[model samples]
Target: MPIIRVTSLSEPGLEVYGSLTERQLKSFYDDLGGLFIAESPKVIKVALDAGYEPVSVLCEEKHIEGDAKDIIRRSGDIPVYIGERDLLASLTGYTLTRGVLCAMRRKPTVSIADVCRDAHRVAVINGVVDNTNIGAIFRSAAALGIDAVVVTSNSCDPLNRRSVRVSMGTVFLVPWTWSDDYQQELNALGFKTVAMALTDKSVAIDDERLKAENKLAIIMGTEGDGLPQYAIDAADYVARIPMSYNVDSLNVAAASAVAFWELRNR
Candidate 1:
């Protein structure tokens, strides 16, 4: 094991776990060559099962003899760095949950076309900035059989630590891509773009149009404002989820699941 002990919070070796903000962590941990911090043993184990390589692990010293020991035994030759609870807390800037964290290398990213080429249905993002929503959408996308996810450069970082954790690490399981010219690419691909909107021209969520086509892309917008006019105008189809008497719409995350469930082939 290449384990190194850190008696002080400022130890240089701790930078891998200490210095970066969640956004920086996402970029760093991406397949482009950086690492991700997986909190909680179960989530870390999930990442490992998905073939992520662990650089090292930090855990409360007390856990070393208990739960941590068993987890490490299965980690093969990976080093386990042990520290007192106070020291681990200071190093990570938060109370350690499950008393374990694993730093793993990011896997390669899949291209938008690669993710979509085999997919019959996909979810496209315009500018949903909330990390939690981004995470939830991925989780729902995976569960509802959405083929892929494409995010504009301006969207929330999908690999954000909070987003990864919120998604139960599903981000690693789903294939996603980024688009600089999001609309043009979809247009050229023969996709029937369906923008989720509440406008009168919008069709019902269960409209036959959503199911009629094999290649479909559902464009979702941020919370405060729905799809921008350009995104709406670019849609090959516009649709809205049905709601009760006084309700206008569901939260984006909730609405996404409903839409995906309705549109996904049975």
Candidate 2:
């Protein structure tokens, strides 16, 4: 492996970790959809185990013999950028957690049909812009037995560095893809759409009718406004989590966990 000790923050190959914008990292000046940075050893390992091709690795010098050792070995002969803790902090413009990050090639995404082909339960993420929420939802979906995830084009990138780290790499464990017209897409694939909204006509999330569907697509909205009117209108059912103490609604992330657990395929 090419273990290059970084001498300066402006080093040629260091841009992928910090200097570049998320879009730039994603496109990386190519047609291939781009790359994503997988932070921390655990997340990076999950990405590698899922067969994501590693472009490079950036890690603290101390971890070279500790947390990052196996990553270097397992990542084949890819470029391994090593630096001191303080310098590494400067590279990202802050002191980041976990001491290691891997820039992995974002493989071509599968079609919505491909991802949901055999899925009995799927989460359709609407315009949720919070990276943390996106990651949390994926973690819950993976743990609670959701079959797949379909993210709207307007939603936050699930593979964004912070999201991937927050998800502890569960993002890789779940099959997923982006959709432009998700309601139409899911319906076309024979999924019964269930939009999580606060409409007057909405049903309780645990409604036995929802669980009866052979293929269920649980649709979630954005952080603030919730799902758009058109999205709710297109769904087969509108549902809400019954709350306590006058709490109007839960955060999209928390609601997803509750909904996934309650409506999970039995």
Candidate 3:
């Protein structure tokens, strides 16, 4: 209910929305889980519904009743910063898609074991640093019946602002965590690992043995170079999505969708 107008770019309590870089925000609290921005009313509502804690909200004054009304009401006593579109854009360095952004506190990341506890189908990203592609893959994983996502520590953060926005907020819909030894951990849990690569030993995605496994971990690699030799070696099965016209490969995000659907557990 404390609706404060943002009259200056340097106004107190506004840094989280503008001044801090994603890295800075992520390190804002160390292990306590850093902060992230959820843009637009719909995405903000989704994050809130997922039990993410709202730190504060920044919205255009025009949305006071028009678009952000319900979000504001649901956010309860958090400090709400209102400003004109022009002034607000100057503070954040870009126009918000739906005239609102909320800063939310990140929850502690769980272990890979906890993530795959009851999962039959899981998607794992290794060294994929593209925020947009990472977001798109998460969207596909959530919608295509993949039960969980596990990202290697070298992969891009799913909670990055651009990733969160591009995902249409579905990033919060699927359970995910960061891991360094994903292959080892997953193997121990009885998951058959499938590395989407083009090695000589690679099997087609529809290989019957793949779909027969009750627990699977489909691993994707970086954009420039597909999976590393070591990752492919570590995998229980090296597989490739069938391509035509000698195309040889799909973008990691596109490949992920094809893999998730074809390898999905019935």
Candidate 4:
């Protein structure tokens, strides 16, 4: 429990918590490994529970003995950097929520086959660049019984700072991996693809036929453009959520929640 008082924003060991960009922090330990900053005690706890190694922690002085106590105890011997409230806020460029953050080591990337090997229900995040939506989808997937999540290379990283916080840490709870050829790999794994898209031939999300499938993969697309033509064409069924008020579609995150809940295995 080495506690370091951070007197200045430029303090040598505080880079990961303040100065470094997400990409820089990601590559911080490249030769040894990569790192990600987890904000809030709750999210940090979840990451720890998921076996993500901790590098260090930053805390506001008040929280050192408050919300951050348990995190400090769980952190073992890692350096716990503490600073006055205003100083920390200035350093982080925002007010700390629950007043704590942790720098965690990223795990090795898993393959699509590894993630979907025995998955009964999966979700594919295809090129969804918005971190908030990506996080929300993972949160929904976890809540609604999705076994795993596969994000295409172009999609936002589930471990992105905002995504992790927005998901309330479910990103760590769910098994996920990157996929270059998501469709081909899912098909090879024996999953019937259900693209969440609007098309003439699309079926209702709650169609009984969807629930009848042995293994299902729900494919979700970007915010503005929706699923690509190839993805729609490749899917066994293109499904749409029934809407009211003349709404044509739901936000990707909202639609994902509905689709996940509706198509979840009984």
For model 1, how does the per-residue alpha-carbon lDDT over 97-190 read when each residue is reduced to its tens digit? Answer: 7788887787675566676777778899779999899989999998999888999888887766677778888877777888856677766677
Residues 9-114, candidate 4: write the lDDT tens digits. Answer: 8888898878889888778889756899899888999999999999899998888889889988887999989998889999989888888989999998888888
lDDT (Cα atoms) of all candidates against the true structure: 0.81, 0.90, 0.92, 0.91
**lDDT (Cα, tens digit) per residue for candidate 3, span 45-96:** 9998999988888999899797889988888899999999999999999998
Ranking by TM-score: 3, 2, 4, 1
List residue ranges in candidate 2 displaced over 4 A: none
Segments in model 4 whose C-alpha atoms lie over 4 Å from true places? none
Q: How far is candidate 4 from the true structure (C-alpha RMSD, Å)?
A: 1.2
- In order of appearance, the predictions have TM-scores of 0.89, 0.97, 0.98, 0.96
All predictions: root-mean-square deviation over Cα?
A: 2.3, 1.0, 0.9, 1.2
Q: How many clashes would you count in candidate 3?
A: 0
Residue-level lDDT of model 2, residues 38-99, one tens digit each, is 88888888998999988898988888898989988898888989988889898887675778
Give candidate 2's error at residue 117 in angstroms: 0.7
Candidate 1, superposed: residue stretches over 4 Å from native: 26-32, 69-71, 74-78
Global lDDT of model 2: 0.90
Kindly indicate the candidate among 1 and 2 with the higher lDDT.
Answer: 2
